[model samples]
Target: MSEPMSRRTLLGATAGTAVAAATGFVPAPATAAGNRVPAVVRELDAKIEEAMAAYMVPGVAYGLRYRGRDYVRGFGVTSLDDPQPVDADTVFRVASTTKPFTGTAVMRLVERGRLDLDRTVRSYLPGFRTADPAASARVTVRQALNHSAGWLGDYFLDTGNDDGALARYVDEMSRVPQLNPPGKYFAYNNAAISVAGRLIEVVTGVTYERAVRELLTGPLGLRHSAFSLEELPGVRWAVPHVPNEAQTEIVPQPAAWAMPRAINPAGGLISSARDQLRWARFHLGDGRVPGSDRRLLSRRSMHLMQSNPGPGGTLFVELDGVGVTWLLRPTAEGPKVVQHGGDWAGQHSGFLMVPARDFALTVLTNSDTGPTLLDDLFVGDWALSRFAGVHNLPAVPRALPAGELAAYQGVYTGEQIYFDGSTLTTQFEVVPDAGQLSVRIDGTEVARLAFYRRDYVVFPNPDGTVGNQRANFVRDRDGEVTWFRLGGRLYRRGAEATVQRRSSAPATLPRPILS
Candidate 1:
């Protein structure tokens, strides 16, 4: 009879020497080591190649840090037109991944007694207000960081790139509606995070970019990171790309110059793979500044930043919960995985770390399809399982009863969400077809929906590369479907006749041109 697999044997089989050395599971190898370095390199290369072929992403820069050693690699050309190959130093726009950096800066201020996470936004800015005055007055710094502030988070107005940008953005929030009361639900709120950035500036008496540089980049020696393309002068960077109308070929996109400077605190940091790894190490380390013993944030504050304060709806389902600007998911064996993903005009990036195993991974790509490469390629899963002994099973969709599916077919109308503009009225029409459903935005079919669980539906893009984005249908007291929530905004179901009559009308918002 064969004995059951021991814990050590299982970990060794899954994670090899990376986790072993970090956890002191066994003696470290003196030369070449017990680590399957060659195998890992080969596996990563193969997966990147496969993903590039499938998703048609123009370029990818990836870095991995395990047990204090770093492994970095680049794949494909910077652009289909330029044909310049990517390298370790190639910078890419890191979109919402910038949130964690902003959050870290706030924690530093908290340590210095310059800011209070529990304090209301009105306390510091005094100009901050929402359509719902009471909720705006009650929303706290912590709520904004964790995305629990119930205001309509999709408000993305560009208030200009002047020194008063964030302040002006806050002043304009009076027109934005409240999705729910403060701290009542978790909706990813970029506008609220931008407010947090404004708070940082208020306390530090410096520009948001300068505060970020002095507090984070300078301390960590992140030489290749900056807030915008103009800041990284003469540096070789990846050009963004998007598919042509036929979806058969990619076209080069201009630099993301239109990205409002006001949102830089939320999703505007551009960085290279090398510096991003360093940033991840700073978080995974003992809350101390790199190359110095001085503490930047207390160990307790770091733990607090990674702790789940309340329920997170869809993210909670997949990742277990969300912390302050971090996504917290636990492996079956009980160790937690902390990570964040970023997306913008024509770029996608991801940063992930396993604190228990002292392992981290970062990937940056320049293409509208880049997100598909990160999620569908199992980049995070491969790193966690091969280096941290964490096995994350792929999520599968469940089939709903025909009757249940029929009830969800309707036309819903709501504000069109934008990253930087006043909200525009938009329409969503759900139509059942052959057991599955199709979602049309502004009369164009954008995604196909499948049942993930009760009341939740996952919309997979028409292209097979991108993974599913989720939506939840909310019912009233009498069990009638009243509203549907997706991308952190609530959409009320419209009367069938009314929606049908209005669906033919031209959309108020212009379709986003990748350029």
Candidate 2:
């Protein structure tokens, strides 16, 4: 393990700032008096700066619309190696947030009577088959959209940059094992969505990117969005950055700039904050193109995309169910929110909207640790309450008896797959504590897992903030604790110690890597 880094080192590594002028997208009469930026937004700017310093994030571009006004700003340098101020037009990879675009394209086809949501996958792709042929035949387009296909979802096979990328990727799903019967449970399945993209390609007779452009992006006027690096020339884009091995200073990601082409439909769109806000605005408004009356989706279809189709639950407590492609959650003040976020190797992006209130927010950052900062600001009462008049209450941690906590003590093992088709063996050790369960990953204790309710656990951040992702312990048929579901992935609770003991060399403690 690398040595620890000092506070000064972390701050110095990320202290570079480049503030640009704020631009509003909403238009009023030229003679109308302009309103000053909200005081909350000014305060949010300082919060972003301080949090960026604390989390070692190099750059951020955010756009927000609330109460019929718009606020857009960028902060910090684009990259440490080559510094450039990020502006409203600066592009950042929005990753899995691209899922919604794919969803929108599928909806467009449905609106045109070209596709059916309830149709089985075999109806569209006759050759589509998973390891469980019986289950494969039952998977529907809606199941894939809602992530209930139940097959192993993290398959990220690189099929090269070609029109057949998604087709090749879906063919490989034949070997993926089904985790549950179709529509039984919810797992965050990237592989399932890739199949949905392939369906779009089959129905539209075009590449996934081209079809999305024709159905959504082109019609929506998102000129700053692109799916590949070659399309980014002459345009400013944020460089991905990550913490060094020492977890001290921020550095650029040493790997490839983007994911495999096959995963493009899952998460491959590079977009600017301005474009993201525009995208959210379209979702918040009626189903028409911004300035034109061209209706991409009917009102019923638009609302259907945001409505829950079946029983589904997410790892995050804030989210209750899944829409067509969006995560559905309710706020404390009685407003429902449809939102999605994305995570690339070193970049993080978020988009959220409360359709009832016409409030939308988009945040793009070029740092792996950006989510820590975003969880504090986005879900915290500051942004949601000040602008949307609603807030999400995180699960409150509660103390439990030692006997109750002891039942969960054990080492659980799992595998995490990345967009490059790489896998990492993961181990989690849960030990008994006075009031909570001491949760350790590998050998390092990272969180104090306490029950918020019955089997639901909440791990608050080190800074005493809530809104951190919550997880749960699963029970087997015999009523014995058997699985640990964290971040929507399952970890079985045995055989890990045997594998470690069988190794020839001494076990070295590696950093805990989570999806």
Candidate 3:
């Protein structure tokens, strides 16, 4: 049997007064009270410490930009082995949060008449083909950017540290099975973003990293942002952390230090909370580089990046639609929120903004368990609602009858393509447990699913309470359950015995994320 599924597959905030009373975390007094920390920020600090304790996260860096006021701060140590206090400049891998940067780069190129969003993928990279040739040809640049490519998105291939890494990665995408036709559905496809990166490389005649530096980060003055480990030596950087085998402590990952070079365009970014706030500011602004009149993209282009909704919906109420690498969460009669997030092996980062309100919030944590903290602060409680008056109210789950729940029980399969081109198959077995659906991987229970609205279900936390993240069951034209969509990847249903034989050995599962 192969190794069991690792935890990278599975991927809190408060007010001060009531928070301190509950968690026993006293907020530090602001210097002299002339600049007393905002009550919401103090509450956030208390909540951060509380969440850090609860999730065993070693360190975190958070920031907020609301109505022209700015706040950025860090907490805990960067690394336990050789500890250093984290500060605003301490860098953490922003992971898939890098998607917006890629999207911005494409927007810049489009404005310059170098690339077209409506063009077919093969028009830019002639070799771009998936398991379905027609679907591959039909896929547009916009479809890839908005993640409607209908192919495998959880692909991870370490295509070396050379300049040709992205090109090599896209060449192997030919083997990925297309789950839906082009523009038919939206699954968070990382491989599609890598294809977009290869397209950037082909258009600019430079590596994806170089193109981004020239197009976005360099122009935006994100001094502390970079895609390379070499640049890390001169600055303070947070080491990635994961839970111990007992799940009691957060420790630095042993060998999973950096992601494969090929996936850099998808989720390989190291940035500070301060820099991330600056990025959020640019997106919220009028398309000019901060402190300069030079325009990287016109205001119209920037708005299109955030406003143009894709045809396929992301299956969440808060997330109204996907736009060029950005998730749009439109609040009725309130601000329109544009956001994105990243999840690496042991780091979690999120960026959220409400352009009309001139508000943005960023959270970066140095542990694989960071999502719980994000759940409380950005998505659930204080930061988003306090700063922008935006809330992502979740659906209330209801008890389902055993017969209705049994329809979801089955063996489903997903795959991960490694650097050397070997594929790791992951099996998800859903069976009825106490009138609810229990999700298992290789007989190990990972989480339970309780129905909420329609085909959507909410994942109950370890304490038997529901969280904000939701997954859904997809049915075919004939009303037969055909797939399970979680964390933006499609797990196709298969014959029980056939799936069991193929999944005899467990493999890495896709980390469920909110991006």
Where model 3 places Cα greater than 4 Å from the true spot, the runs are 1-34, 245-247, 311-318, 330-334, 432-435, 441-445, 462-464, 495-515
Q: How far off is residue 175 in model 2, in Å? A: 2.1
Model 1 ranges with Cα > 4 A deviation: 1-36, 245-247, 315-317, 378-383, 392-397, 402-409, 417-422, 431-448, 458-471, 474-483, 487-490, 497-515
Please give each candidate's TM-score: 0.82, 0.88, 0.88
> How many angstroms is residue 32 displaced in model 1 relative to the true structure, after the best TM-score fit?
11
**Full candidate order by TM-score, most accurate first:** 3, 2, 1
- lDDT, candidate 1, equals 0.70
Q: Model 1 Cα displacement at 204 (Å)?
A: 1.0
> lDDT scores for all predictions?
0.70, 0.73, 0.76
Candidate 2 achieves a global lDDT of 0.73
Can you write out model 3's per-residue Cα lDDT over 454-487, one digit (the tens) per residue? 6787777667776656677888779888888776
Candidate with maximal lDDT: 3
Q: For residue 505, what is the lDDT in candidate 2?
A: 32
